[model samples]
Target: MSKIVLYWHPMSSATPIACALAELGVPHERVKVDIHAGEQRKPAYLALNPNGKVPTLTVDGAPMFEALAIHLWLAGQYGVERGLWPAEGTPERLQAMAWSTWSYVTYGAQLVRLQTARDMGTPDDPHGQAGHKAMDELLALLDQRLASQPWMLGANYSMVDLIVGSVIGYSAYIGAPVQKHPHVLAWLGKVQARPAMQIDA
Candidate 1:
């Protein structure tokens, strides 16, 4: 296999891809992109990811961004039969795609909004309230979907769990009220307990 390098910053959204790579058990190197110190905008890093984001993955020196896309690609290339992702053409694979997309685009947007609102003002502010409403509805839906399943794609843990759980876990950090969604909370517990998801002290 070609050399895999992840340009990353700890605890940012980039963390999940690290978890995914660990779950895949692929040998890789980490090149820290210190966003707070403006390293992501340096000429060399920008050449790899014009967006100047952490979690840009370089496979044999070919760069790929978008954390979810990186996750899918890594899983497809190295995780077959390892259960990090469903095999291509299977119905479970399609479901995984849907859930991953939902977690990234739909749920992720509200999380961003809430975080931004927190920086701006109280959760009672217009933007914050809107974020809460949107998240409440989405979490309710997810809670129902997860009501009977141990993981996102039925019984098996897949990339969907890691992807979705990463964003949902942020809710707790951001002080969003998600405890009402029992199933989602329980599912998150299982997702967080994965060995790959743990960070060393």
Candidate 2:
């Protein structure tokens, strides 16, 4: 087995990758990067991830950063038999890719904007309000999607759910209003209930 080392922080977006690795039952080492302490800015860390983000996974010395990339790579490397990812060339695989991209590019962007507004102490500002509105629409869409399926890809909990749920969890932590979307909330609850998720938490 290739040696795997995951550099992460407890509160960072890296949470989902950690959960995915745990769920896949892959053997790996966890190295916590203290972002709050400015550890991510260190020269050595920046060499691995120029973006200076947490959850950079090194597989036998090759570095992979970004939460979504790490999840996809790990799933490809170790999760096929476990079914954490859709099989190659399957329709479900396309769905997985689409949903994961939506999670990061659409829903995640708005949530990040809201978080930025809050960090700037302007949660009620125009930018913040726009972020909130965008998030509301996205969450509603997710709720509608979940009304017909148990998970993001379908009845099974696949990599898409892990990746999407992590970003939504981050949004919730940053105070995105989740009360109006009961189905989404319920699906999140199920995702959060997983033992691997608990370990990541």
lDDT of 2 by residue, 100-119 (tens): 88988888889878988999
Model 1 CA deviation exceeding 4 Å by range: none
Error of 1 at 153 (Å): 0.5
Worst 10 residues of 2 by lDDT: 71-80
Clashes of 2: 0
lDDT of each: 0.85, 0.86
What residue runs in model 2 are displaced by over 4 Å at the alpha carbon? none
- Residue pair clashes in candidate 2: none
TM-score of each: 0.95, 0.95
Task: Please list all clashing residue pairs in model 1, or write none if there are none.
Answer: none
Overlapping backbone residue pairs in candidate 1 total 0
lDDT at 165, model 1: 90
